[model samples]
Target: MTRPPARPMRADAVRNYERILTAARAAFAEQGSQAPLDDIAQRAGVGNATLYRHFPTRQALLEAVHRDHIEALCRQAKELLAAPSPSEALMSWLKAVVAQGSTARGLAASLMAAIGTQEESWCRDAVFASASALLARAQQAGAVRPDVTVRQLLKLVNAIALATETEPDRDEQVGRLLDLLLDGLRATSTS
Candidate 1:
């Protein structure tokens, strides 16, 4: 039998949800995934019961935060698809991914590490599909080499992310590293 339609959330519930998510994102960014639930509730200006009602477990909250980031990246990739330059589009999305991977603490790393587990991470698949689409477009345009796979590109960017994780000047450092990576990714002119 088909399930019944889910009702839309009330205004107060929506506000609470947004508040908790905002607070949790900040807490996770600052203190990693292990940030205390009570503190998150306090930051959100909600009681512990409200926080628990919204997110039953620490893992649940962590997943929401991680999934939101991944979803945003996927959305960026989708938007970049319409860009006139395929190479530029791919590079733009890659920069965002690198920024995400290089996020201050282990929040991104921990969530990324959990993909494809028992949960059947649609998040991972969405990311791969978006990356492949952008990469394929650039490859077809002859802007990037044909031999480069999505996995290789992602691994390279993630390495750059990890390398700059603790750098005080992460933005500048990521930019320099990305330029080097761009050099390697470009299609060489055959005279």
Candidate 2:
């Protein structure tokens, strides 16, 4: 059996496609889903027609942005895994996740929308696996309580991100909040 021929885009079209995705990512980070496609096209130095050719709908563009951020977050998790200690690695990864969550307004909602689509869930799974591995290591070393789950940690980080908005010392606040969570995750003498 013969496979069907692959559709090939022109060199200029491929360049425009990449530019649109880059501009879309920046715009979504800055302004969320409400970011205008015309503005993205202008930023990419492509016409509206080119942007529409690459992404016909705002949902598609938003999904692309969401997927890109998720991938980057997963990559950060891999980097954190290389740190010396389980506690240090988990804390560092939590900080990175919190920072990403804080900056990406509407990200949680976008991610929910993208979850059940045909898009691969590699990024999401990678992040969870990374967190799980770190948490397991910490638990095994008696640095963290065994009861804590990655899901719980994620929820707490997201809550912190939502709560400290508009504070001039947001990063400091997040650090304090994360420290508190970490303390709670520590194994207790009575347990």
Candidate 3:
């Protein structure tokens, strides 16, 4: 299918857009969703007008950041699929999905909020599509259980992120828990 035409942006506008996103991600990582827009604009070295032109509202900016993260996770899934071991690739992608979902203090909640929204559903859909592709590859290789679904895997990853958000001191526990979850998904013959 032919791709739809994207609106052409001037070089300056494109740079401003990228700068805004980078600054917003850092701000959100430090201060959650409550980070000030003006601070983000200052950090980006752009005026409030420029920031507002790119993202009119706080939710708009948050959604954009979340969308960018989801896109990266999707790309990671594709790259992981090229690994020689399907089980290893799936496990690595699962860890990455959780990390992506938990990078910012409130990023997981924002992503959950995007689930039913008209403009933001594409982000959620893209995550699911990428995850399903990885899961299918592992399932076909008899590495993962045939009964497992992408939604279940995604939910589990989200839960892990939420559960561990306040306990950065227990990083090893997080790994063990994630390993346990992955073990459950393993096909009996492989286990």
Q: TM-scores of the models, in the given order?
A: 0.67, 0.67, 0.69
Evaluated with lDDT, which candidate comes out highest? Answer: 1
C-alpha root-mean-square deviation, each candidate: 5.6, 6.0, 5.1
Candidate 1 vs candidate 3: the TM-score winner is 3
In candidate 1, stretches whose alpha carbon ends up further than 4 angstroms from where it belongs are: 1-27, 33-61, 101-107, 110-119
The TM-score that candidate 2 achieves is: 0.67
Candidate order by decreasing lDDT: 1, 3, 2
**Per-residue lDDT for 143-180 in model 2, tens only?**
88888887777667657765674478988998899888
lDDT of the structure predicted as candidate 3 = 0.78
Per residue, candidate 3 scores C-alpha lDDT tens digits across 109-148 of 5655554356645667787788888899999999899999
Model 2 deviation from native, Cα RMSD in Å? 6.0
Q: Write the per-residue lDDT of candidate 1 for residues 11-53, one digit (tens) a residue.
A: 7877887789889888977876678899999999999998888
How displaced is residue 46 in candidate 1, in Å?
14
For each predicted model, how many residue pairs clash, with residues at least 3 apart or on different chains?
0, 0, 0
- lDDT scores of the candidates, listed in order: 0.79, 0.71, 0.78
User: Model 2, residue 43: displacement in angstroms?
Assistant: 6.4
